[model samples]
Target chain A: MKVLVTVKEVAEADDDFAIEGTDIAESDLEYDLNEWDDYAVEAAVQLAEAGIADEVVTVTVGRERTEETIRMALAKGADRAVRVWDEALDGAFADVASKVDLFEAVVAEEEPDLVLGGVQAADTGFGATGVALAERIGFEHAAVVNDLDVDADAGVAHVHRELEGGVEELTEVDLPAVLTVQTGLNEPRYASLRGIRQAQRKEIAAKDLSDLGLTADDVESSLTITSMYEPESESDAEMIEGDAGESADRLAEVLREKGVSA
Target chain B: MSVLVAAEHRRGALRDVSYEAITAGRELADARGADLHVAVIGGDVDGFAEDLNRDGVDAIHTVADGEEFDHNAYQAALSQLADGIDAGAVVLPNSVNGLDYAPALAEALGVPIVTDAVGMAYDDGLTVTREMYGSKVETTVDVAGDRFVLTVRGGEWPPAEGVGDAAIESVDVDVPESGARVTGFEEVGGGDVDIADADVLVSVGRGIEEEENIELIEDLADALGATLSASRPIVDNGWLPKNRQVGQSGKVVTPDVYIAVGISGAVQHVAGMKGSDTIVAINTDPNAPIFDIADYGIVGDLFDVVPELIDEFA
Candidate 1:
C-alpha cells in the first residue's frame, strides 16, 4: 500500500508566542515541522515498520525554506518528499497564500491511496485544512483520529475517531482517503544525524500549479486579519501564606465569600 | 436570509450537539429576519429529521443512504443542499466531524468559515464571536458575504426549543460515491467518568505534581459525586487518558459545578469549562487565570486544601 502524508511549517511548539497588540510575533520564534504533522509522519512510518505499506511519500506546501521540513520528514523515514514551491506564496489566500486552497491543490495532484495531516496548524490554528481538503477531493474524512489500521489487500482502512463522552466510532472506508492524525497518535521518532545525511541523497520532487493543471483562481480567502495585537493580561495570583491546615481554612473562607461553598 | 444548520447523528440517534447548533443557527436567523432550515444527512435519519422539526425548524432536508457520518460525503451533500435552498449562512456544531467539513463546505461555496464560533449577530453583514489562542482572548469575526459556514463551540448555546408547527420535508440529496469508506471504530477505555454529562467536575492540572497525588483529587470527586477530569498537561504526562483532557484540545464541558484544584488555568483550559455554573478554584497562585472566571477562589496549595475539602464534604 502507498500513503501520502502532508506536513506544514509552523512556529516551533516551544516558542514564547507573544501576542503583541494584534500581531503574533513570529520574528523571534524558531520554525519547525508542526507538532501534529509529526504524528502523521510517524503514523505512516509505522505502517512501513509494520510491513503494511510498500511506500510512504511526504508532501509539503511552501517555498524553499520548507525544504528543511521535508528533509526532516525524510529523516523520520518517509521514502520521498514532494515540495510545491511557489515563491509568491505569502501564507494568505486573497493576495498571497491560502492554507485550504493550497492543500486542496496538492491533494488533487498527488491522488495517493491515503492522505494524512496534522489536525490543525499551530500558528493559525484554523484546524480546517485537512477536512477542507478531503471535501474538495470528495474523499471520506475523519479528524482527531488517534488510531488507524488499513487492509492493504482489500484496499480499505478502518479509523478510530475520538468523540465526546468517551465514545468512539469506527469508520471503515476504502483507500485514497484522508485522515487527520491528532496528537498522541504515535510517538514521533527523532531524526538521527545519519538519517539527515541520507535525506540529502533522497529524491525531493518540486512542482508548480501550472504543471498540475491547477489555477490560483481555484482558491479564495474569506476571513481577513484586520490587525494582530497582544491580549491584555487578566489574572493576578495571591499567595496564601500558611501551612496545610491553616491555608485550607483561609481558602474555605475565600470560597465562602465568593458563594462557591456554604 | 435563510439559516442552514447541519444535523449529525449515528445510526438514527441524533447528537445532542445538533440541537445546540440549531439553537445557534436560530439566533442568526432571528437576527437576520429569516427562517431556520436544518439539513439532516445519514444512511437513515428520518427520526433525526423528526426531532429536528421539534425545534421549530422552518424546514428539514433528510439526505439518507451511504455510511451516515462521513465528512467528505456530508460536505458535498451540504454544499448541494446549501446551493439549492439559497441559504444565507450554514452552521455546524464544532465537533470532530463538524471541523472536518466546515472549511471545505465554506470553500465549496466560496465563503469564509468562522470556526469555534460562540455567538452571532446580523447587521449589514453577519457578525460572529469566537475565542482564539486557546481562549486567552475573544475576537469577533464579521463576514461580508451572504453565504458562509460557521461552527459553534460546544456548550456555548442552549438547545433550540420545540415551539412551532415546523414540518419535516424529505429531500433526496444524491449520495456521491465516497472516496473514503469507514471500516471500523474502536473505543478507548478509561471508564473513570463521562466529563460532558457530569453535574460537577473536579479537574486537576500541572500544579498537582505527581500522579500518586491524583488519588486526593479523586477522593474529593467522590465526596461530591463529581467527575474527575484534568487539563491537557495531565493527559500528556500520562496521569490520565486523552479523553480526560479539558481544553480546546480535548472535551468541552458545562457542568453545574466545577472545582478546579492545583490548576493554573490556561486560556485553552478555561475555554473548555468556563460555562460551568459555579467555578471554585484552588491554586497556590492567587493570580492564576483560573481565578479570573472563578466565582470562588482559594489561594492555597491543593495538597493542603483538597484533603480538607474532601473531609468537609464527607
Candidate 2:
C-alpha cells in the first residue's frame, strides 16, 4: 500500500505584528510545519515502518519558501515529497476547492491507497480540505480521527473520530480513503541527525500547475480577501500593573475578596 | 432564492449551534430578501424540526435517517434539499460533524465554502468575516458568486427565540451506500476528577513549556485548594489527562474562578471556559486572546508570577 499525506507550512504571528493588506506582514510571520500535519506525517511514517505501506509520500501546496518546512517531514521519515506551487496561486486566498483541484491531480498520478492529512491547517483553520479532496477524488473519508488502525487485508481503516464533549465515534472506513488525523493520535518524532543528513539528499519533486496539467484558469479562486484588521478587544479587565511579586500581592488580595481559601 | 440552514444534533438532542445557525440564517435571509429554510437530518427528525421552528424560519424539512451523523447521508440529504429549494446560501454549524460534511456538500453543489464564520455581510455580493492566526487577526473574504456554503461558529450569535409556525415538510432523499460506517461511540475524559464540578480551576496551557514545569501549576492549584485543569494541548501532550482538560472536546467548565496560566486563549479552549464567573489570565503577551475575555489580568511570565502566586496563597 502506498500512503500519501498532505502537509502545510502554516504561519504564526509574532508577539506583536503588523498587518499588510489581507494578511500579516511576511516579515512578521514565522513559518513551521503545521502542528496538526506533524502528527499526520508521523502516522504515515509509522504505517511504512510497520511494512503496511510501501511508500510514505508527503504533498504540500505552498510556495518555494515552504520547501524548508516540507524537508522536515522528509527528515521525520516521509519517503519523499511533492511541492505544488505556481505564480498564479499567489493571488486570492486559495479556497478549499482550489486545494482539492491541486491534490486531486496529484492523487490521479500517485494513486496512493490511503491519504492522511491534518484535521485542519492552523493558519487557515478551514478544516475542509481533506474531506473535499476525498469527495473530488472519489475516496472514502473520516474527519477528526484521533485513533487509527489499518488492515490492508480487509482494506479497512478503523478510526476513532473525536467529537465534541469527550466523545469518540469508532468508524470503519473502506480503503482508498482519506483520514484527517487529529493531534495526540501519536507523538510526533523529532528528526534525528542521521535523518537530517539524509533529507538533504532525498528527492523533493517540485511541480507547478502546468506540470499537473492544470492552468491558472483551472485553479482560479472565486474568493477574494477584501480587508484584514485586528479584532477590537472587548476586554474591560482590570490589568494588575506591577512586577511579579507586586502583582501576586494584588492577585492574592483579589482572590481573597472572591472568598477563595484553602 | 432561499437560505438553507442545516441543524445539527447528536445522540438524541439538538445542539445549541443549530439554533445559533438559525439566527445567522435569518440574518442572511433577511439581507437577501429570501426565505429561510431549516433542515434537520437523522435522529428524531420531527422533534428536531419542532425545536428549529424559530421566528423568521419560513419552512422546515426533516429527513428521517440514522440515529447519528453520517456524513454521506448528510451530504445527500442537504444537497437534494438545497437543489430542491434553489438555495442561494446554505448555513451550517461549524462543529466537528459540520467539518466532516460541509466541504463535500459544497463540492457536490459546485459552490465555494467558508468555514467558521464569525460575521457576514451581504451587499452586491457575500462577504464573510473569520479569524486567522489563532484569532490574532480577522479577515473579510469576498465570494464572487451568488451561491455559497457557510459553516458558522457556535456562540457567535444569539439563539433564535420566539417560535414561529413554520410549514413543516418531510423530504424524501436517497442516502447512498457509504464507504465509512460509524459503529459505536466511546466517552473519553472520564477518570478521577470532573473539572466542571470545581469552583476554582487552575488551568495550564502551552506556556508552561515542559512537562516537568507542570509541577509549578500543581503547586499553585494545591495552594489555592483548587482543582487543576488544562487546555487541549496539555492533554494532547499527555502532560495532563483528558478528564483534566477544559475545552470543546474535553469538558465545558464554568468555575467561579478560571485562572488561566501560560495559556493563549485559542477559540476551542475559550469555548469551554469563557463562561467562568471571574476569568484571570497570566501570560507574557498582553495581546493574547485570553485577555480579551479575562476579568483580571497580569502581564508577566508564568515562571515569575505563578511561583509568587503560590507563595502568596501559602
Every model's DockQ, to 2 decimals? 0.29, 0.89
* TM-score of chain B taken alone, candidate 1: 0.78
lDDT of 1 by residue, B1-314 (tens): 58899988765578788999988888888878888889888756776776787555898887776645777668777888888878878999888778867777886786777777766677878767665544444555656577778888777788887755675777766656665556555555446666888777889998889989889888887776678899876886678887687876577889877888888786568878989887878877654568888776777767767887666656
* lDDT, candidate 2, B39-151, per-residue tens: 99999999888888889999999999889999999999999999999998999999999999999999999999999999999998999999889899899999988999999
- Superposed Cα RMSD, model 1: 5.3
Quality of model 1 by C-alpha lDDT: 0.74
Top candidate on DockQ is 2
Model 1 per-residue lDDT at A238 = 52
- Provide the overall lDDT of each model, using Cα atoms, as 2-decimal numbers: 0.74, 0.94
